[model samples]
Target: MFTYDTTRATAEAFAVAAPIDAPVSRGRRRIRELCADCVRIVLADLLLVLYRLRTVGLENIPTEGGALVIHNHVSVVDWLFVFVACPRVPRFVMHYRDYDRPGFRWLFDAFGVIPIAPKKEDPELLARADRAIDEALAAGDLVVICPEGTMTPDGELSPFREGATRIARRCNVPVVPVVLVGLWGSIFSRKNGSPLSSLPRAGRAQVSIVAGPPVAPGRVSTAYLVEMVTLLRGRHR
Candidate 1:
């Protein structure tokens, strides 16, 4: 193991050899992120056409600063719609099993998806996910979480877990509530109790994404979020 002096000396040597200009690095990173966003939007356009998607109150998603975006989980493609709708590229907090899937791991890693499991499954994994979320929020990054923990089996909304409220309070960030309408009977939903076995709708599904104003951290709660989302969802499934 290296001592403090040795580590400092090594760092100094590297810095001297290749001094990094902070402003230039930041500018380059911003440009790269913008380019990536452009690519994401282009890909999302295809889905938009396929789904005949519409969005409402999208301005509620902050362009800057950290916040928790909590939404109901009704289908497998819910995250994709949220990902495409947000102005800022948000980091998704997804299930560890999904993140660790054999073929899709590369895609999740490329987008920096945060994989989380229950403490009962693995305490260390849960701890790491919590830390990653905190760090991301501290860095003013948007973090999206599906508080239902899993997709609803039926077309109705499921009771939300307390994780979203807890994170919002701890990080002192607002909670942005979003609702996905018209995904309940889609192929991605658990309509037949299995997404894989379900078939796509006959025509392009008219999907709507409704976003509400950010709720203050002090007022955040599992019930309140569920209510807000339900109201936004209206009579739609």
Candidate 2:
């Protein structure tokens, strides 16, 4: 087991960083209260039926705050591990393009996922998303993001877009880097010319999630973020 205390730490990895101070929510919530709770229950049941999530270092996740969680984008269900690691309720910054898919749309809307236009050239969309992030942080909620922008075509890692640092700086919130490993080899792992229907009849996965220390804003850098991401990725190797 690995232990981490990241709720308090100075930022040093980047040339531009700031202190994020999103407060923790004072109210109470249950995962069932989100948009489509019955579906979330179904997802939980599916996790048991199809995937055996071997989660570790959950304690590394900060329990409370306006924290920005940057994670690797692998499978479509990355949020599942986060829901298990983060507090009962966590918000995701998802892509607008995914909102229309029936199966995924149900889940996304049910969880109150905030959507961002997939087109990076859309300044208005970006601005809207930035404000939504600020509002969510100000309300003391956890925001889960995949800095790589989209799901990887292959399981290999991709470049993390620069938006994470911006969100951290804009909200002055600590960025927690999370790595989801082993899922690519699990039931939902992608295959050549195979669609979702081709997934195994039943499968088990060795899923793991490790959170790095919460990094302060203002002093964050691209290298530091990569280093943190690399550290999280190391757990699976």
Candidate 3:
């Protein structure tokens, strides 16, 4: 929905305002120190029971260090699948509206999710998100972003946004591109109609997550990320 210029311009402005060397807040720093294994285990098990999840190339996720994770936006539960598949608990950049959801407010806060508004709508929120992402990476934490900006209206990939690439380039971190398969028809997805409007499919859905090796910051771009994700999705298609 956002034009390339708007997204890139906001990101560029944020990069200028918030240098990569900026310090992280004490509260944020302390939260990142705590292990989220318990939460991760609980959510991963729940998803496993509900959907037949298959993962490949998880080894590509670095055991330690700051890295940028870029993935396709498919379903509302896509982040859950990503959390389950990754070795570390990643701090995600989520929409501010989702963060304001009544029931999930605590979850997002506890997990240190960064809330962002679209650049065109609220450049201030986007600036804060960019700073948060830069600080998190500077603190040597894993950060995940869905460059498609929102879930797909159709079951096909959307053009990538420059925000993710901008963050990676500014922080000089590796970007890992991942693709999720077989979630398009699920109740959580915008498939067949409005999400949650139709009854959930009868049986457990089969899902797969494929990850490609990390792309260096210098080499990573929106176009390259789109190409990699398209190829990965093609494997399952």
> Whole-model lDDT, candidate 1?
0.76
lDDT of 1 by residue, 6-99 (tens): 1212211211111111122344334434443654655587776688877888899999999999888988888888887888678799998988
Candidate 2 lDDT, 118-166, residue by residue in tens: 4546667766667777887777778888888867667777887788888
Which is the leading candidate under TM-score?
A: 3
Scored against the true structure, residue 207 in model 2 reaches a CA lDDT of 67
Cα lDDT computed for each candidate against the true fold: 0.76, 0.65, 0.78
Per-residue lDDT, model 2, residue 160, is: 74
Question: Which stretches of candidate 2 lie above 4 Å from their native place?
Answer: 1-42, 103-107, 118-121, 191-197, 201-203
Question: Which ranges in model 1 have alpha carbons more than 4 Å from their true place?
Answer: 1-39, 235-237
TM-score of 1: 0.84
On TM-score, the stronger of 1 and 2 is 1
Task: lDDT winner between 2 and 3, please give it.
Answer: 3
Judged by TM-score relative to the true structure, which candidate is superior, 1 or 3? 3
Error of 1 at 211 (Å): 0.3
RMSD of each: 10.5, 9.8, 9.9
Ranking according to TM-score, highest score first: 3, 1, 2
